[model samples]
Target: MNTTTQPTHNTLFITCFAALVATSFCFVLRAFVVDDWGHEFNLSATQKGELLGVGLWPFSISIVLLSLLIDRVGFRAVLWVAVACHLIGTTTTLLATGYWSLYVGTFVLALGNGAVEAAVNPLIATAYRHDKTKWLNMLHAGWPGGLVLGGLLALAQGGGVDWRWKIGLVIVPVIVYSILLLRQRFPVSERVAAGVSYREMLAEAGYVSALIVAALIVIEVGRVFDWSLLLQGLLIVAATAFYAWYTRSPGRALFIIMLIIMMPLATTELGTDSWITSLLEPEVVSMGLQPGWVLVYTSALMLVLRLFAGPLVHRFSPLGLLALCSAIAAVGLYGLSQATGVAVLLAATIYGIGKSFFWPTSIGFVAEQFPKGGAVTMNVLAGVGMLGVGIVGSVLLGTIQDRAIGHSLAAHDAQHATQLHATYFTSEKTGVFGRYLALDEAKVNASDAQTRAVVDAVVAGSKKTALKSVAVLPLIMLAAYLLLLLYFRRQGGYRAVALTQSPPAA
Candidate 1:
């Protein structure tokens, strides 16, 4: 377990980084092609959000489940599962016939993504135990690297190439990473090497964290299958009760607070990324620019910044950096809500820099603060973030767009709005928030050019409003990070906890 002496350390790190790059390939490709799927499947905005969310939320299931078992099962085995999932999910998506097929494909892909993180996060954390935060940030550079590369590749394909072909590109990195990693020797996790018992690791997360994750799973799954309220509640209770009985702890207070903070943080970063291409489509297209370029541009910035995070973490400390980034992100999101023409790129630059460190730094914080929790603490934090963005953030943003468009259309032209509602907005969808009517894509397409123009204008406004609505998320995160900064300051100063040392008292 002496990481410095491990011969495969650098190669394994590269392989892990490549695996994450493969995951981001799936993400960026899906983000770019979501509109194509919407058109082909005649999907509403909400349905499109569901497609995007499926590409994310299912990540939680595989990551959380696999994290708990990875120590016993080994990293290579879990990565092999990820490889299989990638191939199968890509194949399914390529052959998709409609919304349901696309949903299944994305859901399976998310599972593969989760598996990759479950293996790589702890693998890298253990590999660079002495410099966990710095190395983790360096490792996560692959995410934005893939985003930049994948986004550019998709953009290069232009309007002529089929979306299926773009999706198939995910297999390239998959093949490369699999070849590099499958034959490599895996390392013992730091927790196991330190003789941290299974019970002790479980205590690091405990029942409170378990309850939050369990509840989100139940709620999201219940929504999908139309499960009764009673069933969902019972499932949540049973799951939490079992965990509490076994762990006999409420979880550390700071870990729980971090878990809560993850929701808004994930929504601000991943959720915004999920919708950015579509949200800015009208503005970008009007300026004769491709919407995907904004994503590519932002990702390139992130890629470069993350590669240099070691210095930044040193200067600001982890919590201080998070607090600073949260405020920057809030400003950036608000700027994006109002930016137009060439200014959009400027806004995106700020937003990209702000979000660049959020994911990796958060992981670093959890890994440093709760090393005894091992993969469970790190991956659970990631899983909950994905769950939050998938079930709530993505879908809620779509709902906001739909509602705003509906309201805008009504206020603009009441008679026309009523006519359009009767014709196009015929689908009634219910989500966690409540029931709302969504515009049917097929019906919208069948409308006259003038009607389409009017609808487009309304949609453009609504998209901006959606961005504005989401701007609040980062503000919430800023407040939370500030409070955490205060809490750490009162305790003397923020410091990365070591495995041999005890974590701060709850």
Candidate 2:
């Protein structure tokens, strides 16, 4: 880590941007092709949600695990690992034959995505330490930028193109970033540069945050392996005890609060994006527009706004901006639930603007507020956000849609509902939230046109209702952000904490 010979800031920033573009390409493409997977795999809505969830939750594991080792391992080494994961993950996805194959592929892909964030986030924060929020926002513009590109490319191929070809698009950016970063000198992290001890860095996250992350990992892993509840509980307890003994602290109160807030915040942003196309499909189709256009259009909005986040941060302050956006997001989601046809675009505009800053700004806030935590605090927040959405949010929304459709159909036409239930509905399936039945796509496809029509109408209404259900998440976020704003005002004002050479008293 020599300072003089390291790559210029612009060069490193561009390389980081390219790496993020590669990750976002995978995300948007998978989201676009999810319906295709549902058709091919004869999946229930819950199962489709599981696929999407797996694509995200595994991100937490790789990110948290790698964050612990990144400072010791160096950025170049960790990035090369990410590059390998990307290649293997994409190849696995391309060769998929069924749901299990798709699951494995997506799981691997998420690991690569996690690794990318683990390396790049701290890299940018270190490069522009004085103005982390602005540079980090600029760094993340690459995400929506990739989405806009990937979504448009997928859309351009028309509906008739093979999904395998669409998935292959991820490889192009992967190659581009790998080439850009090749042989580039990397810098020591801000924590290291500031002479912050590793023990102090671990102290910032403390025991409580570690327990939350550990519990999530244990629960999800247990579910995957069908581990007994006793085993899962023991693992969580053991992990928490070790962390508490070592850290001897409950964690900073504000940082702990932020971690809790991340759950709904993540659901409102990434969870909704994951399902937007499917949720709005019927309305968008009726208007003779591709469902994907909505995702691309919203992503485009996010891209432009994120590029200009500096002024907003300066004007509203990070927490203030977050509070305002959460309110807008709540309104936007409710509007989406009620909007129809062309009006859907208008509602999406508000949502696009509202969610545009949530992810990057939240990261910027964590990096600024907890600079002593270095990559661990920032990446852990990100990991927790993904874990929350993947295990809870995405699956919960799908379950909501499933339950709503069943009830709506039964109420509308009991005899038809009974027949459909006997013939087309899946048996009860269990998820993180609870057990629920879902429509079996294969059987539904085999039903008569009249049956399909009735089911489709019910399905559309259910999707809308699901959006309304999710609207509560942003409202929850709004309350949390407002409280944070009030707390910061009482402390004189919001300000980024600067690291000093000597560690502050514990």
Candidate 3:
């Protein structure tokens, strides 16, 4: 056993919030630099998707492992590991020369990210056990705040700035958080404080939820790497056996269901946020607005709104509020797909508001419904959300854009398509939509005026198509929220569970 004086609740809260800001900075950093990597590496759309997802899926590995071990290892120790990962990961990324190196860098960075969430989510929940939703929202306000700051920094650097230097910006937040967290002592998780056993906490997650998340991560990795059928089968069987052995309780069906729902919710939020700047670039350029500003604008709205989520949660109830957001976000995405000129602002506003509460509110819900589940439940849920965007959402959206562009061009300019086909398309590898064209920089640079125009039209159309396609995700979320709202209504109303709070001095 280890003993250390816990830091004040306010101090821990601020440190965790800074950690999240650093994490969020890492999340959006790629979106700004991906095109540069594409040009330098001759990356295909699918490859770019893989790059985006790389920052996410590895998070699950670290979070899952650490969530199980955090109680034994101590939070401060795990956090120091996180700090090292961030420093080394950023250095690795800056020094990267090729695809594999970049992949390694991103994967390591995600390890730090996962570690942060695993340590901090439970820290904040325990620190403010009585008002988990409100404080959690306040803590998560760091995400959008970081995005807005990063967006502006990207803008000030201008589009022509070096990718390495742009990525180096994250070092600032990493240092800020490090200074804040390095010496602070962490409080025990609420469950541990309340004398809840590890087995009881593990049982709250159960075999069903664990199995579902495990399968999704396995399938995503397998799909990306083209794992052999036997390998996939073995992994599935292993996961099944482990979860079956560990989980004894019947489990909370609603909590398990929410884990699955988090996939689409993540897709609707982070996935969309990842692509929004690229998706709106053509319109933003035409309207004399910087593409980065669109992200900044949306993220600004998210920052402000999330800070005030407490009142909204109080008025609408979490499920009811989420249902309302779903409707607005679905409509907003569809409108964004169709919008031109100033109308883009209107659509983005709605979308930002919709996503603002998703990640934090979901965490709050798990804390309320299954306080006994402890850090494992919270980390698993956060891990799944990240994987949802990185593995499924980002990858699928990239493929959608690839196919949409290829198809539109094939229909209108078969000769040019044939030329591009010979230059870029491979018959052996089909993406989610169809055969993908490797985005060859040389060929693109050499295209004639008319060919370039045709390519631009195809790209513009494809981006729009991608936006319209993703709009469906929020519609699906709206339905899920409605079901949850009705369920809560039947149960009387939304009420947060009170766990063991920190002592008076804390």
Candidate 4:
């Protein structure tokens, strides 16, 4: 009934295009806002984490809201409303000189960004019905694509522009997309096309349940993305027995549980897919080179990879490609955790390439299996990813850093676990005492104070770094997703074997 070669009339294309812009805007805003505000806010550790989480928070909230709203009004209305919110939010950020204002503005921007996803994700399924998963991958890849642009600008040119100018920069993309959507005529959802009821639309996101399962897995095993052998063994037996009774494989149980483990992993991976610019600062500092520039180069490659993702997914089978990519990412993240200097910079770049396709492939896999609920799945995946950034950053990574290098370094990032008031991230701000508690270790190595100073320093630093760098959890999760991708290759296209092959004759 519908046929169009170009995206000109492709509702998904136009809406996805807009979604791409919105996604890019959200990450870009998040990427730079942290750096700019860090300078302006002189923020405490808790404030900084909260500030960063603001970008992630609105996204999660928007996902739930969008899931419910799209079932009612459909996408066009949601898309426009989202764009309007982003515009207002971005514009208001210029007025922010304090915490609450900045929070409100960033949240509004995320709201709009979240809304874009609500529309485009389901739109991808509805539009490209056959390749819903592939298209969804392509569509969601827009996020890393946006991050590519966002990070490049923020890291490379960030110093020259004021935060106001940075916020202003989004206006161009916003205006261009608004114009494109205006010119295009869109369509109703796949549910509308097939005459399915709204109740079914709600159930479409089987992957959302899957995401919850994966989120739990990540929490339980502490393995970012790999399946716990124990969990998998239990699932295999359960699924086999369950399938003996019903026509449909009861694997959905495993899928849901998997999300509990994997959703957080995926989200953590993406959040940390950020530029290497924020690598911890040593006590002795200089202006000559900042890690941000390293991030710029890494982000540039990320953009380039995303642009080619359409073809890559076509060739490698999305899941296989993701596994390979994630393996590369795992090495990168672990390496970053342990390495330093230019070597660390190089590792981050390697991590970047590995990270390039993790989300796209995973999102694509979900879209293929759970077309109707793609938006909800995307939200869960995306939302959990945001929260992963917070949790791993606030909890996991901080603990590791404290134990390994917190006391050795000039900064002791932890010191909060000692208090009953322990929230997500509180130690990174407790002040010079925290710093000296760790730094004084070098001076007192021979003094009677050595034992107490070092012990105190490690605890505090671990806490601090755990919160500071939990974003790495997602990067590690990417590796886990990659393995899962290999397992699910049949469900999507692109097998593991093909990942190693060169592109076929065009």
The model with the greatest lDDT is 1
Better of 2 and 4 by lDDT: 2
Could you estimate the TM-score for every candidate? Answer: 0.97, 0.97, 0.93, 0.70
- How many clashing residue pairs appear in each of the predictions shown? 0, 0, 0, 52
lDDT of 1 by residue, 407-464 (tens): 8866766754356656666777766677878877777788899889877888899999
Give candidate 1's whole-model lDDT: 0.90
What is each predicted model's overall lDDT from 0 to 1?
A: 0.90, 0.89, 0.81, 0.54
lDDT of 3: 0.81
Q: Give the Å shift of residue 36 in candidate 2.
A: 0.7
Tell me how many residue pairs clash in candidate 2. Answer: 0
User: Per-residue alpha-carbon lDDT of model 3 for 215-261, expressed as tens digits?
Assistant: 77787767658887689778987886787687766468888878888
- Model 4 / residue 184 / CA error / Å: 1.8
How well is each residue in 312-393 modelled by candidate 2, as lDDT tens digits? 9889988888988999889889999999988999999999999999988999999999999999999999999999999989
Off by over 4 Å in 2: 1-7, 415-418, 501-506
Q: For each candidate, C-alpha RMSD in Å?
A: 2.8, 2.2, 3.1, 10.2
